[model samples]
Target: MHELSIVMNIIDIATEQVQQAHARKVDSIELEIGTMAGVEMDALDFSWSAAVRNTVLSDAERVVDRVPAIARCGNCGLEFRVSEPFMPCPACDNVLVEYLQGKELRVKSLVVS
Candidate 1:
């Protein structure tokens, strides 16, 4: 699954941050992953358990904030919540839209120790 790669990428980022902070361990990590980020929670959880072994995040608590996808229709100038990336504007059924949010995948904060 792509979740393994995603988790590995996150581990890489955490490792770099921890090293840069001169920390041997991590207390917690906060992540902002959007609903439209194409991530599977179940797969991510399974991958996380295996990926964190013996790493800086081994004992770290992982907290994720799921951001809802919000988009604005270009044709009708309507703002609404979207479930997927390919969602059409409900106001005018326009394919042209501007994404306001919900495509984020990043580390928000980390507690190092």
Candidate 2:
């Protein structure tokens, strides 16, 4: 699965950050995952454990924060949260909605010591 590659990349980045910061070890890695980011959280978690097996971040805990998909309707100016893609405006049934959040996957923070 692509999740393996994704986790591998994450581990690589975390390792680099840990080295750069000259930390003894990485305690936690926080990730912000949007609802529409198309990433499977469970798979990512499983892959993370496997990916970090032999790395310096082997003991690092992966924390995922779910970010809701928020969009504003162009026709009605209504804002709402969505769980999936192709979300039409509920109020005006408008297909044109500007997305304010979601579709994002990023490492938000790292706790090192």
Candidate 3:
């Protein structure tokens, strides 16, 4: 799965941050992963354990904040939560929309010591 690569990237970032801050290990990590980011949580968790092995994040606590997908209809300017891709707008039945959020995939914060 590509989730492993994502985990590895996280590991690299965290490691760099920890090292830059003169920290030995990361205590906790906060991640913002949007529903529309296409990341499978279970698969991510499984890969995490392996990816962090013997690394600075080996004992780090991972906290993922799930962001609900939201979209705004281009035609009606109506905004609503999106449960699936290409959802038609409730107001104008427009399939074309702009995402306001839920495409996020980033590490929000880290606590290292």
Task: Write candidate 3's Cα lDDT for 29-54 as tens digits.
Answer: 99999999989999999999888999
Compute the lDDT for candidate 3: 0.94
Model 1, runs deviating above 4 Å:
none
What ranking of all candidate models by TM-score puts the best one first? Answer: 3, 1, 2
Worst-scoring 10-residue span by lDDT in model 1: 83-92
Choose 2 or 3, whichever is better by lDDT.
Answer: 3
User: Which regions of candidate 3 deviate over 4 angstroms?
Assistant: none
lDDT of 3 at 69: 92
Candidate closer to the true structure by lDDT (higher is better), 1 or 3? 3
Whole-model lDDT, model 1: 0.91
- Candidate 2 per-residue lDDT over residues 1-112, each given as its tens digit: 8888888888788888989999877899899888888898888878877778878679987788889999999999999997568789988889999989987789899998
Model 3: weakest 10-residue lDDT segment is 83-92
- The reply for model 2, stretches above 4 Å from the true place, is none
What tens-digit string does per-residue lDDT give for candidate 1 at 1-113? 99899888888999999899898888999999988888988999999999899988899999999999999999989999997667899978999998898889899999998
Task: Check candidate 3 and list the clashing pairs.
Answer: none
Best by lDDT: 3
